[model samples]
Target: MDAIYDEIRVALHAVWRRRWLALAIAWAICLAGWLVVSQIPNQYLSSARVSVQLRNVLPGQDNLMSQADQQRDIDRVRQTLLSAVNLEKVVRGTSLANTVATDRDVADRVAMLQKAIKITAQADANIFELSATIAGGGASDAANARLAREVVQKLIDIFVEANLADTRDENSQSLRFLDEQIAARQRQLQEAEAKKAEFQTRYMGSLPGTGSIEDRAGAARAQLAQVNSDLAAAQSGLAAVNGQMAGTQPSLPGTAGAAMGPARARLATIQGQLAEARGRGWTDSHPDVIALKNQLQIAQAAARGEPMAGGDGGTPNPLYLSLRSMQADRAAQVAALTQRKAQLEADLARLGDTMGAQPGVAAELASIDRDYLVLKDQYDKLLASREQVSIRAQANNQTDAVKITVIDPPTSPRTPAAPNRPLLLFGVLIAGLGGGAAGAWGLSKLQTTYPTVQRLEKASGMPVLGGVGEVVADATHIARRRQLKLFAGGAGALMGAFVLLMGIEFLQRGLVA
Candidate 1:
């Protein structure tokens, strides 16, 4: 422990003896450090804070934006904010425009602008901070601060435009497209309705899905069967009536002159032919139908003992009245059957017309209905989407939807944000101390004369006998000591002047814009 203390004391004594040289080395290192630190540019930072609202709640709608979706939108906005187009716009709008004289300079300025701007969003929140940094390489502090503030303000403007105007324009375009589609669909629906109406008018009662023509024809045939049964029953009743009056009744005068059997047979044959003609889809105005009616009239006239084309105006015998009455009743029954058969034939003809058009009309109507329905469905979806987009656009325009608003405006920073002068100065001071200590140690090592006998023995590994003491100085030694003092003072003064001149130059450069 004593040896260690002795070594420390020797090192201290050596440093004190060479103190002037140590001071010169320390000051030189400090000046160099200061010059290097002073040459670096000062950076200024300007920041603005904003809060964005996701959505506005409205009646019958949940307009709240989801966290993931909002985050994605924010990411997209951030990317757009840093895009080359927007960066170029920012450059043109600020003092950066003055720095660009050529295409390459513009490109360089844009790159610098991108690196200087920054956007940050709070997690799970709608708050954001936009910041810009200006490194004034050779400019003044005031210019750096002003440039940073301007850049931040321009970024805020871009953010607002993206959230409002762009969204509204997109919605307007979508609404126009939906309107055109809806109009086309409406025309198609109208055309389908017109076609269905025309088909119904042409086919009358034979529309598919309403009762069919074959059904109506079957119904007419049923009515014809019932009429025929009634006619047969009436004939049987008339025959029975005639049988009861056969021997006791006297013949009528008209019946006594005419043979009723031949005339009755001929009328029945004419009636059967007319019924057959009517069943073949022939109208009452058809030539075949007209000829059948003429034949039936002639047959009926002959039955009454008149000329073939005219009815008789003669009287009848009283005794034959009973038989004639039965015959007349049978004739009336046949006439009623014939009328009913004609009515059934007319209905069948009408039903056949409806049946003929049913297949084609049903197919065409189905195709029309399908087309109309498909168009209607698409139109409805497009209309609904347009309404939703319109609502969102309106909300944005009104500042009720997701939008960025300036919460804290940008301000010119008063202090330099870069260089960290105090820290740098402290580091330089430490380095100065180290350099001074190193110089002293080097000087001590170069000296061959050992101040102590123990140090000489340790270095040379030889035995030390004794040490010699120096005599007092004479007048000549005193003069030499005074000259040495004057020389050291002059050198110190020159170094001090050099450091002062460098400091003034550094300060001047720092002040220029």
Candidate 2:
């Protein structure tokens, strides 16, 4: 460790003794670098900052775009800001495309502008800053401002149109729902009314010259009453005959009284003689038989306490009924007719009331029907309009899926940021340093290492040997080391500064700080 320290000390001393040589080479390289940097063209950089203000079109609603999504949108917006279209437009509008204006100088400036447009987003920022550099051209400010404003306005217009289209679709959908619902309700009302009308007609009876079922119900009831009266009279006649038969009593020969007296006997003999005379092959309906039948009818009537009808009327069979089938059938028919009549009467009364009410209802229904026609026409027209609008929308490429504009307007530039002279000079200076270093290294490779060997041999004193000669030590390496040492003592001190400066420059890295 002590020997290594001693060698370091010796090497430092050797560098000090050759101070003029080190100083001259370093000075030459530094001057050349400075001169080369001075020859570089002046570059101007322009920058414009823009803020993105997102608008929530849904009123009173918060924006759903999260911070991450918003960041993506910002990046996307940044990309759009630096799109080829905008660049092409900028280039097309500028004099940068005309390569023959000042020929080489103008072309050089234009190429610089083309290469230098930059866009950047700050961390969690809503703003975009666009920057450009122009070499020998004037400034980069005004052109960037124009592009930002133009793009922003175009995006805004696209968004506004999209919003309008969405609103229109919403309105159209609402109208369609209303149309369907109204039509369904109308059908239901119509069906209910038709049912009511059919029931009214089926239950009602018809009458000649009668307009309603109620008008015929009264006549039906009157017919049933007359039929009932006829039935009662016929039943009474039958009852009378039955009563006469029941009251009649025959006298007996021994039990009740003595035999008939001479006058009753003689009278019976005369009646028997008369009946025998009339029964000579004569029908009961013959004149002679009819006379006898009448005499018997008169006797029967006398016994029954009934007046005789002109000696005798045609005697009917006691077991038979006039229009017999018709009696039962008419009774059933009457009952059914009466029931039907009653139902019709009720229905008719209801219908009359309904009709009276219908005067108001019918007016309303008529009005509704009339308005329905008008509404139908309007609905048809609206539907047709909607269809046409749909077609137009398709033609215009404005469909259910609309293009959304995510980009916003650009902010105004606060300052003209053109002509960044100091930054350009610094960059040029760095380039010059790099070039000088590369050149010095290449030259060192081309030159021989005889000087380095002479110094090494004089110091070590163990040289005088043959060796491979393809590779060599660097002349510029010595100059670089000396230059680094001088810079290390750059704190108001000379190149051969104090030991402290040397320790600070080299030993600090190797041994101790």
Candidate 3:
């Protein structure tokens, strides 16, 4: 412990001997540090908080812009608030504009603003916080403060403008795109319609039925089958009537002419019914046709056995005359059905010939019809989309989709937010003092002088039996006292300068306020 104390005492004595040099070093370092600190510009910050509200005034408008979409738009605006263009606008709108003379200067300022501006949002709210800082622009503290506030204000204006303008622009673009698509679709539809008309006129004008060749051919085949069935029924009915007439007597055994007997009347009724059934397109295999044929046979048998009473001269047999009439009607029906069948067959034959002559006609017609339908569908969809866009645009014009309220306007800062000058000044003073002390200590280490006999003995590795203290005269003591006072005054002056700088810093901040 004694040795450590001795060493500390020796170091102190060595530093004291060069106290002037140490004080000079401290003064030099302090002055340089103070100067640099004074040159450092103060930074001011301005901030604002805004709340955004998304409203849906139109019915079913949520499908167009949902809450998530609104949130995304808000987030997008927040992220782009400090973009280069916006920053340039800030620079031009604020005092920063005075410093920029050329495009390059503006660009440089924009870059700086990019770093100085910040936008943040709440996690679960629609509130956004915008802040901007201005520093070291050769402008006064008050000017910088005002610039910062102006920057934030400009950002707010841009935020609101961007939301409204972007919505309108996007809606307009969507409408234009839909219109173009609708027009293109319309042109395609028109061309398809014209092509279809030309194709029908050139290739399908003579074809029966409407639609493609295959459909017409199918319809013809179906009609031919129906005609054949009806013709067979008619032929069967005609044969039955002819047989009935052949069996019926021309006159009654006692009466020449008389009203038809009950059986003959029934038989004639059945014959008429048979003819009517055949006229209705009923085939021979139909249940009604079968039933009628059975009734007709029964009637014929009854008529054959019935005795007739009439005038002596035999009148034409009523049953035979009725059979003749039925035969004529059935024959006419048969002829009509035959003609129809022939016409249908000719149509089928013509369709077959057309298809064989032009194998691609049906395919071309089908493609034309398909294209026309597709174009029509597309045109309708585009028109609907255009209408939807137009409606949304109108709604947006009527009411704002996004509403922004300034919860906190940009504040005017009285003091700098950065470069804490007082703290920095104090720090520099302390550093200067430390550096001076370190310099003296290091200089002492390089010297061979020792303030204590023990240190001298240790360094020389020689035994010192004795040591003598220096004797000072009265005058020398007086001189030493005066020198000590001077050194104290120098150190005190350095401390006083530091205090003065701190006072000035506070006073400047007050003036700015």
Per-residue lDDT tens digits of candidate 1, residues 1-513? 999999888888787677667767777887798778767777888999988876543434335443244456666777689888888888889888888888888788788888889899777467888999999645567777888999999998888777665556656887788788778878877887686667666664343223334455677878879988887877776665566456533523343234445675577666656644543347999998898889888888887773433234433333245345556777788788878878777777766665574557545656666776787787788778778767766655665456567889996776667767656765775687578767987899798878788989989999989888866669878986886687578556645645565565457435633
Which structure among the candidates has the greatest TM-score? 3
- Clash-forming residue pairs, model 1: 139-513, 140-513, 250-319, 250-320, 251-320, 252-317, 252-320, 253-317
RMSD of each: 15.8, 22.0, 6.0
Q: How well is each residue in 202-305 modelled by candidate 3, as lDDT tens digits?
A: 98887889999999999889889988998998899888777777887864444445656788768767876776666456899999999989988888999899
Which parts of model 2 are misplaced by more than 4 Å?
1-5, 39-44, 56-85, 91-111, 121-126, 136-513
Ten contiguous residues minimizing lDDT sum, candidate 1: 310-319
Residue 293's C-alpha lDDT in candidate 3? 94
Give candidate 1 misplaced runs (Cα > 4 Å): 16-24, 55-57, 65-74, 180-368, 446-448, 460-463, 472-513
What lDDT does the true structure give each of the candidates? 0.71, 0.46, 0.84
Top candidate by lDDT: 3
Residue by residue across 380-407, what tens digits does model 2's lDDT show?
6656655644543343244322233334
